[model samples]
Target: MKPAHRSRRRGAPAALRWPAIATLLAAAFATSPPAAPPAAAAANPASFAANCGTKPVTLQGYFETGFPGTVELTKLFTKQYPNVTWKIREDPFAVITQDAPLVLSSPNPPDLMRTPQITGLVKDHILLNLDRFYKIFGWDKFPASDLEQLRVDPSGRPQGVGPVWAMGINYSMTGVFYNKALAAKVGIKLPPATLAQLDEDMAKAKAAGVLPVEQFDSAGNGGLIFPLQYLMADYTIAASGSVQPINAWVLDQPHATIVTHANLLAVEHLDQWIKDGYFNADANAVPYSTMMARFEHGQGLFIFDGDWESGNLDHNFPGKYGFFLFPPLKAGGKQAAMSAPLTYGIPATAKHASCAAYFLNWVQTNPAARALNVAVYGSNPGGPASLPIPPVKPGTVTAQTLAAGRVIAKEDGAMGFIANAAGPIDAEAWTPAVQKLFGGQITPQAVLTTVQADYEQELSAP
Candidate 1:
């Protein structure tokens, strides 16, 4: 990104006003001011050190439900750094992902916020570089992958485009989960990497009176739509020879790069799945829980799910089921991928940066923290292999899974970064476009045509 573009990303004016506002709030309500007893009294803004401890810092923390360790971290951060109180801000993960940039771009930027910030944030220059904070973060103490995951650019190269805002608070992967017993009943193996084979198995399962797969649609957007992204990634990787058809968009932002054959093929596969009854006829409309509920009741023999399902299943009986990464759709294809929700970094102006450091440092050193983090949030920070403490029921995602993902990252010469998570490419176009394609309302060629046309028509115009 250019220097001028970088400047525009400066949280605008709303970001600049936050410190003053936080300071006033802290001072005025130090004692938790009484609720509107009479006329409103003006409050003074609070002040704090941008670095840590020494100067009073008011850290604005953003987190999602089930994001383990944050609430505790806020408390610990305050204790560790006097005068540093974290204004804990929690929201639905999706809302946070979609609007964090807008919120951050506002005048009073978050001093310290959390979200699964995407690579685009780094490309756009909205994050603080933690290169210097390495010493503070005590990077040497943790596994290398975990340390690198925290960096915006682990390679320290600009071309790679790294994470600008968050560290992995929790990690989860999307894949196919199946009932082992049912697989046996259906006379098939588990997690068929090839969808053609899975289709055959599904036919058998359906004949056995089971919904071969439980895939929700838009109403359950969080899981299905998101899990589908991995299929999209695989398609892009196999067809385009690159992700998002980078083309010249790296240098020119006005015009988006074009789509590849595999991109359309992936969408087509999804559409076909819908048509074949392998997925919901209108999966977009059903809630994820309904699908899971069906699967748990043994109404469904197969379920396309991920690690997060484990937590919900464990707490609630989702029947006896086993899981694995969603195998590749193509025959003789590669194994499943590490499609994650992603994590983020902190900004330079973060009020509780130093405090975050203390907690982050603790993240590296403590096993108990890791265990609690996993059980509470269903995340595998670096990888199951790199975990300081072994998570209970570390099923398919063993250290080996983490190792393979790392190897893929190393060999592919780049870790995957989701385009939507980055900046606004256009949710309206993206979701609707994919949904239309998935529903067989369009073809692969048509999907690509739509993306290209949409990009040129909407993003390129003055």
Candidate 2:
């Protein structure tokens, strides 16, 4: 979620404007075809032993504030390679999105920075093309789907083909995190298997004076988008048997639209949830942190969030929470969730690209680093599918989220965040539209039409 600080750097280039960036991207793709993936032998594990070299070096990084997993991983990296230290800068997710193009264009950019949307940055020739690193590190060995989200075609669309631009320290998944004690109070013997059962449970919680769901809908962040997208995925799958339409829309495929019948049904469901008071009364005012705090304090029965918080919940409130994918529409039906990497990339002008690439590869393959990813971030350390997941303690929230991630993988139900449909789609479109829905100012159909209109305008900007 973007914070209130949405300022851009002074005197930034006009070319950096998102619409202009899109135009430039289309031009680039038309004239110069994207390079094919490099061919190389599998990277040997022993090769990483000295990938960073013996000389003293310091890596510059820009990371999202409040997530300690990346910083903690950097410290671990330095521990193994004492000569390599880090000088890091931090910002909230929204700030990073606004600043990414400017920073990547700077003469002195961070060696490694958190990447937001790639379509613009890729087309502007600001982000380093990691096709070479892919071969050098034998990243091809990882599951194809694991890397697909990071791939972009010549047309700047994410078709899971073409050169790889970034790599994930760990892949994150999203779902429902419920307070276990509250579940027993509501007589929910097990997590709901169907949406109807979930609705029934939330009604029970409300009857018992419990907040049925604690989600944030604050302007800019619009945390409600989580459940809305989850519902869209469920409805899409129920109708079409796959999430490709939603994924294609998010990947910016030509002629893609979110105004389908399934999506309309999804929005109507969320509108009903709003009308039924399933969400917090002050949801529109709550931010991500406040919502998490409220849930942790037992102020609500459930929260929709990503696996990134699993470790924090396990550590702070041990044995108090349980997680499940948003229930499917029918018993034993397929499930889906928003899952993507905490992507990081090097600037085209970065000074230590090689060492930075080494660090990225190590984060996934090194036993200690992979363990830190699981233990600290509670995410899958994405590497070769053959590399077993680090053992998680039973009964921990991290364990449940990890298990849920496997369910998503097996079902092929992963969908990118809908907010990422375009550069400003989250803040300028979905956030405002959904907030209006919560305020009873807009109908369910209006929510879809409004966002789709905004999406078209942004993508077609001159």
Candidate 3:
């Protein structure tokens, strides 16, 4: 399940205020092509010499859930800098989101933590500014878009453009996972190329006496939000003529709101999917884990989830499932997907702050670390420069997932995950509003208006 968005109540005035709606719209629909990806650069491990002074160091750290890459990266770091030791702990995402501020404020905060709830953490001055580190490591070599995910204004709100406050260890995207065996059973020879074709395939799956999609709604909005946001991202592009506006809105840019026509179309499409019997009848009753279990057990033809599940799916199903981007609404439309960084930041009061910075710097340049991120963790290492494209092994779901990430990167097709916008806008508003729609208690239009109301309230807060 996605973690709930968190907002900070105590902060100086926002460093980046909301942009005017007109400005946001113009930028979103701007026709200019994105800049070219930069050439790869060699990392200077020599620059880290000053930080690795002749002192014995034990670095304490925490991470959301259990990302094995953290352990692998830590081990790799210590091996290279043998003077340093690591004491790492793990916690569930919800717990981390709620407790990070308190933990960071303590006199003995972990030296480093996987902090995805950056809006609140940045605003509250819990994270150390990495400006000097960024300069030393030449981390600005990363794609501007990749770096933007880590930037926040001085007031701590996510500005999508400003000082770098954090960096992502892995890149993740939202996409469609299908049961290859079931696809064959339903006579689907190739993945659908358009939304209409996807709907047709879903109809076939339903007719073949299988659940068309495995989704969960019991604990929260993962079931609804994931696929719906995928559609919302695509629809935003189709409506506004580019994905920039949607990214702006999702990054909490000034004047961005959820009550847009694209979002309305996304919700309407979801309602139509439900009415067409594309989802499980027990969708409202099942949790996301159960849904994945059901999908892995071959109870559904397809599942909507993130790349984080790729490792699990590969282990359990092997060649059984295939991963693909969600087909566009129309032929040749943008192949938009929800994406964000598996980001981490250092606490200002961290005891071994330099060691933490060295580790972050090492992640992007070390081929072994990047491979572990992909092969073991099933994540795209959002490093400064691209790694050699791994050879695709046929029938490997992870290979396909990495391929999808490459496409997103090459095409500049990632839009922010909707829930990353704000707490009130997503967890407090969209989640329940979607549940209401799923339960037949409200309409798609109601979902739009309700979320917009909460978004406005959040922006207007003191």
Candidate 4:
């Protein structure tokens, strides 16, 4: 979920925004290729440091406000390289999703930016392709799945193919987070091993008068989608033995559909949970921060969220929480979760594009930067698989999440967020649709059909 920050403009309707975005991108990029550093920088890993130059250079950055990892890393980089400094503007993730096109096409774009949906941006050449840096930095040595979501073909249809367009400061994964004390009170001695066991656990929590699940589903940022997608992964894997279908749907593969038997079953399960009062009654009104606050204050037994909050939970209420993957359908089924990079990209028009790319590489490979990423962000500081994950204190929530991320890596079950299926899909489609579902105004099938229709319409836009 995005941090709560004031949006600069009311979100423009997708119908109105896409045509304007396409026109702006055409004007911004035209036939010009993205700028690159000297050929020597591409030829040798040692020479890549020279691309930023020794002069005083301040890279302009656009970042999401809530996460401290990026800001901290910028300060560290400046300390290490006194010749470099940063000028960063931070906003909530929702605003960035709505404003990415205008921001990327501006005359003086940020040298580095947190990217939203990139199919349109990549197709229009608004985002700089990072294939050159990929070779120079040997990022290919990291797990291939770590970089797959950032790759885009020339036409930008299928996402997990072709050249890389972005890099992650850290890779994040989402699952179930439970209050340890609350769980024992409800008699859930172990994390559920299957969907049936999970259902029984929620029932026990409800019977004990504990709020079963603390979730958020406000108008623009629906957190319920986290569990919904996890359920989808469970059902999909149970039936087909893989989550590639769901990933394919997220990546915008040809003829891919979210209206599948697995997805329908997932939505139905979510609906049943809502009816069983597993979720808070006023969940529709709650924002991400409110849910976080409520769960930390010991109001709920469980909350579904991402590893980004692991560090925060560890700091605020140490040793009180536990993390687990949303259980699979059958006991031994392969587990999956919405896992992907906190992707940052350079603009085609950035003045310090080379320096921004250098920072991205350094974030992964530099020991200090990687440690900051792990300690502050509580995510996998994605570098080569051989690089040890910075030591996390045992029994901390960060430690559990890091270990869970390894399970995901070994299973190859990393999936992108369904909310990111398109540029406006979350704000305009999934969030509103899920809000209606929470209010009992829509059926389980309607949620899938409604979002799928909006997704198709948005993708087909000129």
TM per prediction: 0.68, 0.88, 0.86, 0.88
Write the number of the candidate with greater lDDT, choosing between 3 and 4.
4
Give the Å shift of residue 202 in candidate 1: 1.8
Q: Candidate 1: where is the Cα deviation over 4 Å? A: 1-59, 66-69, 72-86, 94-111, 117-126, 138-159, 162-164, 219-258, 297-299, 329-333, 341-344, 383-391, 394-422, 455-462
Writing each residue's lDDT as its tens digit, candidate 1 over 1-462 gives: 699898887764776688889999899889775532222211111322224546566767667766545676556556655777767677886788777666655445565566564454554455555554555454544444443434445322222234323556555555566776778888887656565676688778777776677766563253444444556656665664544343133222333454655655665666666666766555667666677777777666766655665655655653366655555556545443443434545654454455564555455345666655555545465433444445455453333233344434443422233333223433545556566756667666765576566655643343
Least lDDT summed over 10 consecutive residues: which range in candidate 4? 36-45
lDDT of 3: 0.78
RMSD of each: 13.6, 10.3, 14.1, 10.1
lDDT of 2 by residue, 18-137 (tens): 778799889888895655223222233334333778889899999999889899999999999999999999998879988998888876789899997887777667777788777778
Task: State the weakest 10-residue window (summed lDDT) of model 1.
Answer: 36-45
Tens-place lDDT digits, model 4, residues 1-462: 233343535587688899999999998888678753222211233344525789999999999988778999999999998999999999998788778877887777898999867777788777887886777788879888988889888787778899998898889999889999998888886578999999999999999999999998887778889889998999899878999999898888878889988899999999999999999999889999899889988989989999999999998899999999989899978999898899998887777777899999899989999999999999999999999999989999999999999999888888999988865688888998888988999999999999999988876877
| Alpha-carbon shift of residue 93 in model 2 (angstroms) | 2.4
Stretches of candidate 4 exceeding 4 Å from the true structure: 1-50
lDDT agreement of model 1 with the native = 0.54
lDDT of 3 by residue, 37-152 (tens): 23222123344453656688898989877677678888887887798888888998778877887787677789889887777777767677787677777776877877777888
Measured with C-alpha atoms, the lDDT of residue 292 in candidate 3 is 80
Off by over 4 Å in 2: 1-50
Ranking by TM-score: 4, 2, 3, 1
